[model samples]
Target: MRIAYLTIDNINDNVILAQTFPLLGRLATLPEVDGIDLFALRKHGGDRYRAYLPPTRIRVRVGNNHGIWHPLTWLHLVRFALQAWARTRAGAVLIGRNPISLLCLSLAASRRGTRLVLDYRGLLSEEYVLQGKIARRGRMHRLLRRLERWAIRRADAILCVSERLRERTVRWQPVAAGKIVVIPCCYDPRVAGRDEATIERLRGELALDPARDFVLAYAGSLSVWNRPEAIREVFHAFRQIHARTRLLLLTGDLEAAQASFGDEAAIIIRSIPHEEIQHHLALADLGLLLRDRSSVNRVASPVKFAEYLACGVPVLVTPGVGDCPDIVRREGVGYLLDADLPLSRIVSEIRANRSDFRARCREVATRYFDGDAYRALYGELVGGKAFRRLPESPSVGKACA
Candidate 1:
């Protein structure tokens, strides 16, 4: 069977999608599955255009440029729906984060008797409110919430990145409880398994003195939800405990973050290519994920946590948000800080348990965050069975062979 995957974001730049691509590549090895076609609607000037095939080898089609605003985006949605409806004979329509695209894809797939799986990566409306871009009780927020509810209700299945998000979505759309599935963002073992030499080389290149200074690293978007202030707190605590401890931040918003905290840290590397992330991870002694306690963050499942574990780097995370604390606790991989805990206490704990912490990190990645398990989960979701027997080959068409 053929499936049409839809997205509105810059699919090329999204790390979650890139990580999942290998799983999709593996799924293509299934004997019973035909193929997975990606349909993306992108912006171009004031008008939208379509491309039948993507520029790269990735299985995707780019539709004509759609205007970024309301009515034009809706028109592009209708056009994309028509195209997807006409192209795929029977299977599933996998909808990504776009609410407008989900609505149109739902309608198209319903007409063509195709199943719909909605990938609600995050609560967009709630995210907007948490970012202070929109007021939670305002007219626009209420309207978007209504649309989100409608889309959730319409989906045949809902794929959430975290259990917390699944719970929240079910609470909002109680009817979707049985339909919801949790598939957290995971680290691809291929990316996670860099050689020791490569890692050491990266350490040298970054000028990271592992013997002299303890490294604290944070990688990903430098957004408000990530709580830059928490980094400051951690650094302050580190200074009190160990004068040589250094903080390193690698993020997309380098200019803004630099403006905020560049002068404070001993070393701050701005955003690097996603490919270079593992190198930084390898150089780090500790990983930090300290999010603000916003409603959006409460359901966040950050990919960085898994990456840290995969690289055998211990993490220091905040509790009461998403599954990070639970996973860390269950796997014995890292420490979880209560928001009310004094920064000094946190620093003391880290300093006291450094050796055990690193060991826990290795154990957790080996046990729970195994890439084989992640591949099997994706296979089950898409092919209705595990992919344990699948071979590692680059044949894109063999996924559903």
Candidate 2:
């Protein structure tokens, strides 16, 4: 069946959506499927706008972006939705993080008898609340939450990035249980394969002492909620334990993080292209996933975790947030430290079992987080009979929560 994937964000620029786009590319390879169309919104010169398909045969459309701050952006988005409805004979429309797109697509799908699939990346309203950008009980927060609930209720299928998020969505809107599906953000090993020379070049350029220093790496947005403070604490602990240890932070906000960390024992590199991530991961000895146990962080499925695993790197994670720790512990891929654990104890664990941890990292990715399994899962969600039935309780929510 023909499917149209819609998102407000530029698909090429969005990290998560870009990773998912390849998965859709794979789905289009299936025998029963006709083709997949990707419609992304792009900003135009001044207020003028237009729509055009991507050069790739995947049938991509770049709809006019009414500058994010423009008062008429929503109206323009509605117009784009109507145009998409008129142009494609899609059986379903998969809507991404854009709520305005969700509302418009839902309406269009209803009119065309096309199914609407809502891919909820995160609880955007809750994220604002945790960031202190919006108060929980504020009128704007309430209004946004109402709209989120409406989208959840209207969706023919709801895909969440993590099980915790699926559970939370249902708790917030009970009717969501009937439609919600958890398709955790994952790593594909194909994405992990990098040229050996490129990998070596990056390691040499970074002056990474792979044989001597134990590289402790963290890659992603160096934002406030990620608890850069805790990461600094871990680096401090790493310094005390091993003289040959160094912390590497790969982020888009390297300049800001360098200012934030001051003279900390960490090397901060500004963001690298997605194609080069495997090389950076290959040069690293260990991975770090540290986030504060805030409401916004609790249900996150940070894409970095999968990237780390794909590179066969061991991870050290903070407990009680995301499924990373559970995946680490259950798969024996890495260590999970309690938030309240003594820094000395954390350091000791890392020093004591470093070898086994690295081996486990490779094993876990092959055995549990296999890319083939992920592909099969996506295929089932899109084509199998189970798509209509509610997923089993254990399969649809957080393991710990």
Candidate 3:
């Protein structure tokens, strides 16, 4: 079957490269897939990500960026939907990687017999309300919620990032239960690991004291959803007990990081390129996946959680951030930290079993987060029959259970 995927995210966004592109690449390689047409909107740095696209069996189109929430954006998506419909044979799969894409693409998809897939990430309208972007009872919020429901109802399949999210989706729209497939935000195992040389190099470059300093790393944006203030509070509390510890913030928004943490001169905050993130992550002894206990985070799976584990770094994650706390406890890979909890005990535990944690974290990451592990799952979602035969890198990782 031919497939056409549309994402409203900037083609250059880390989400596109880390999650969407990998899924697309996996789909393109499936024997059941004839070819894939990927539709995206270009902004600055879009060409850089374009270079990473699969060179065979996939064609890409990065259209002009008219800006999000603008009227032109909807028109652009409508055009993308119509284009995908016109180009593909009947019964081709049309996937919308976000709510906006799904809503617009569904319009064109309904007119055709193509299957529609919703790449449901989280509670979109609720997220906006939490971020203060929209009032909870406002017309825009209600409209967005309605459109989200409509899109969900129209989807032939729905890809959820967490089991909790799938549950929530089902509760919100009972019809979604049968169509939903839980696929967590995964990481590429190839570049994610602990390399001795990389650790040494980054240690020297960042002036990190290997003998004295215990490193705690946080990677991602300082966006409202990330709760940058909560990150700071956690790091500060950890730092109070472990005076020699360093908090490393590897973020894309350097300016925002500076604004949030610049006053602390001892903090190491850098905006490293996406390709170099794993190397920087290798320098850390512990990764921080702090999040508020909100509805949005409860059903969300942050990619950073997988990334930290993939780099052989155990996390100090918040208790209710998606399925992370359960995984951490089940695998003995990390600690579940609460805001009110004291850090001395957690610190001692980590110090005592750092090596064991590192090894176990890598093992858990291979089992859960590796993209290779999810190939068969992706095949199931896309209705591709070659999943069992899909190429596996025996040296790299194992298939998902």
Candidate 4:
């Protein structure tokens, strides 16, 4: 049997590291996975994450540069169909994401003995609408919903990024309840475990006076949905309590983000490699994740949430941030942001339970968002529990040979 992962995301995209790459790696780790192929409509050639991969197969369609409006977009779909049709055979499972990929891949995966598995990584239409990219009931909006319904009906198994997302998906397609599984934005435990020396060096490089200041870190896209003004508000709140508070902004477009907070004692970092995120995160006393409580947010799972925890840094997030709210309160590893006064409570509590929260946050990361969880979930998807607890091990799950 062969398993294929199809996506429209560029192969080198930072998100692909945490999403597509880790998934394919987990499947490749499985002994039962005979052949694993990753099919991406890539931005460029060669895989940047090849070193991190667990020897998975790769097949990509390059030169895709446009969105739905472009004529080349449809051509990309036609090319994918031809390529997928050529490789069509018995006992194949195509795990797909993105509306274009899932909609088009479903057509080719219709061949006998091929399975279609939809991984709804995000609530696409809802998100786009919230971002003001589409009208509430526009032509594009309806088309996206139609595609989502089409995939839900055809998917043999469905993977959701969060439990709330899975529930919402079930609400839309009631009959899909049985086939759904929640697979969150996962983190590699290894990335968060930097030695003391590495952390110290990173601190020096960033000129972080961690001994005095409370370093707060926020990485990834600085999207409008993040409520950029609220992020500034949180920082000012922290600065009020702690005089030496500094915010670390790690994003691809640091210039735009830095302009929002001019001349503050902030370190604006752009294009930092995915692996190096841990080093910067290590210097922080707390991680910050605050987004609008839009309907699209209810099903959202932010990779930063898991990565922060894995690095043993507590997160300060607003309520309704996917599973973080539940985990933060339940585990006492983080706090919920109060818009009226965002950082006061977390800052005070953090002073007393700094050591305790560190351990608990890492624990939560392993229990919930660890990459190992996905390994088991994928294992279960393929057959009888491909991921299992080893008799001799204390960890939650281990890859089966």
What would the TM-score be for candidate 4 when compared with the true structure?
0.90
lDDT for residue 98 in candidate 2, whole number 0-100: 43
Query: What's the TM-score of each model vs. the native?
Result: 0.82, 0.83, 0.91, 0.90
The TM-score-based order of candidates, best leading, equals: 3, 4, 2, 1
Tell me the tens digit of each residue's lDDT in model 3 across 1-401: 88888988788888888788788888888878899888998767848886666556878877767766677776777788788767866668889877878865765576556788888898888888987878998998999889888888988888788867877788888987667767688885445644778778778988988567788899998877787888888778778898988889999898888888876866898887777888888888889887778889999889999899988888888877888888888888878886566688777777787778878988888877777667666777778222232233221122211
lDDT of 4 by residue, 1-401 (tens): 67777777676777787666777777777776677666665565455656656556554455474765568866876777777777777777777886667776776687898878887777778877887778989998998889888788877777777767777778888988777667677886456668889888878877777457787888887776677688788787778888878888878766777677676646445558778878778777888889878777878888888899998899888888776787777787777776465466667677677778788888888777777656656766655332333442222222222
lDDT of 2 by residue, 298-383 (tens): 78877778778878787788775666777776676777876575655645665577667656676666554444554544554455
C-alpha RMSD of each candidate structure in angstroms = 6.2, 4.5, 3.9, 4.0
Best by lDDT: 3
**Stretches > 4 Å off in candidate 4:** 44-53, 266-270, 339-342, 384-401
CA lDDT, every model vs. true structure? 0.66, 0.66, 0.78, 0.73
Between prediction 1 and prediction 4, which has the larger lDDT? 4
Clashes by residue pair, model 4: none
User: Mind sharing the TM-score for model 3?
Assistant: 0.91
| Candidate 2 collision pairs | none
Least accurate stretch of 10 residues (summed lDDT) in model 1?
392-401
